[model samples]
Target: MEEKLKKIQQDFLNKTKDTKTLAQLDELFIALFGKNGQLDELSKQFKDVPKDELKKVGPLFNQIKQQLEISINEKRGTIRKQIYQSLQNEKFEIPSERTGRKEKKGHLHPVTQFEEDIVKLFEKLGFVQTDAPQIDTDYNNFEVLNIPENHPARDLWDTFYIDTTNYKLQTNKLLLRTHTSNAQIRILKNNKPPIRVMTLGRCFRYENADARHEHTFEQFEIVYVDKDVSMTHLQYLSEYFFKSILGKGIQARLRPKYYPFVEPGVGVDASCAFCKGKGCKVCAGTGWLELAGAGMIHPGVLTRGGIDPDQYSGIAWGVGIERMTMLKYGIEDLRSLKSGDLKFLGRF
Candidate 1:
């Protein structure tokens, strides 16, 4: 087994030496480390060794595995350096703007435009814009927000776990945040009461995509904590937001729902803008479109945030920017907001 490992190591080393472009390195990486690759196939043979022999083989196997990974990384760095050094020898010219000046107006992406409008509206309501990490620790994203590991509620979000092998000495479980609410714990722990902060950014979910869904999407969430905060405030904010965006006639209703992080959770739904509360495909024939999830912050969650639940109450809610944009523009397909086609984007 040791001899075979040494042979494999030498072979990969030689291939690494021959590898040039980053593309070639990527393909080589798959051959060596990807699923069902050379190393994986070899590791399967470990069980064949006697237990006494297995103990000796295991350590050597690990040592070679790490060495190969380091070698690959070093080769990648050398290639990148060569590319940058080559750029230094190359020359380029920028065309004079005055010589071929033509007016070319670029349109803001539909999602960005919608997000900006929401931000401005929140600013009026004393909500300061804040930013949070798109990639965050699991403790912040789920456990601290009242969704602990193995909780059925965790199934509500299909989270993307980070590949930590490349991250040096990382101990904490990390993931691509499934919701902007990942910022909720951060906001509460860092800020004192009367905190009205909103965060807007990209969220990732490992889920199938269709016309109305995306694997990656934009989300905006507000974390509000203050003395005597109540469900009334949540309702008011929802109604005010819907009326402002969809005209004063638009009505928003709250229905009892279950969200692990909040007490008395409610789903905020709005009368269908397309069918005027009548059944339609856009509303899934429900006469209302689900817009946001919200509720009074659970006492346990507040305690974890270093806040005395007895003194301060809180509310948290999040909205999908793409969905709101769709409602505002009478867009039928959520996919269109992200589609790069000029003909579709030019309209907005």
Candidate 2:
């Protein structure tokens, strides 16, 4: 057994010197030290050997393994350095043959470009950018927004409910917020009025995804509350936003719409950019596209936020960022905004 172990050690030490690459070293390791390998089989044979020879065999086997490991690691380091050097010395070579002109660089993603443009426009209007947690309590997302638990607006169950094992209630009540408007409520509660805030973020819903609808989407909310604010202020801001986003040729119209948090809500519509309000496939031949939902703050919402409705008024508007992005860029599908495909995104 001692003679066999000596022969094995000599063979390994002599053979490994020829290993020029890490892969060759790896093969040697597996052949000798790996499971079901030569070294493992030798160790297993110890049970059949005389008891007095067991101690010597175990230590010899360990010494061989340790030496092999040291050599393998050292060779691996050298091989890695050589490979890195080769890579560093490599160069890109252009073809010698003539080629056609490459295509022009693609445009920005419509959503990202439009989002920046709108945020810049609103910044100029003195609306500071604000954000809220995507995961929110029912109070901040609902009750504080004047959509109490049992309100008809709660029927808007399209929201994503989060596991609330951590909450005191220990119920499935926390959620992925459904709209950026929830930020308005948060702003009101944390900051005293004379607040003009805008939020941009993702909102999740349980709705079916389509060309015009996405289960996850983006919306921007503009909330302004101060002394004696009115519908005229809301209209002016709405018109300015539409004109800024869609260009001077476009016009915006406000039509009555209802929302739980806003009294006498209005749907802000912009004249279709495509066909310029005459009629087109972009606007579904309506000559108008619903752009945003906006209205004056309801008294209940004001009271809930510690603001006196009689003493202060606020305007809140929720704009579908995807919708606006699609309109400005003539994008037909809302899903395009969410899809990360470079082919679709690069056309912005």
Identify the leading candidate in terms of TM-score.
2
* Candidate 2 segments exceeding 4 Å error: 1-108, 148-152, 163-172, 278-284
How much does candidate 1 score in TM-score?
Answer: 0.69
Q: What lDDT does each candidate get?
A: 0.87, 0.82
TM-score for each candidate, following the candidate numbering: 0.69, 0.73
Worst ten-residue run, lDDT, model 2? 94-103
Clashes of each: 0, 0
Task: Output the worst ten-in-a-row residue range by lDDT, candidate 1.
Answer: 151-160
Mark the regions of model 1 whose C-alpha exceeds 4 Å error after superposition.
1-104, 152-157
lDDT tens digits, residue span 294-326, model 1? 999999999998999999999998888888888
RMSD of each: 18.6, 6.6
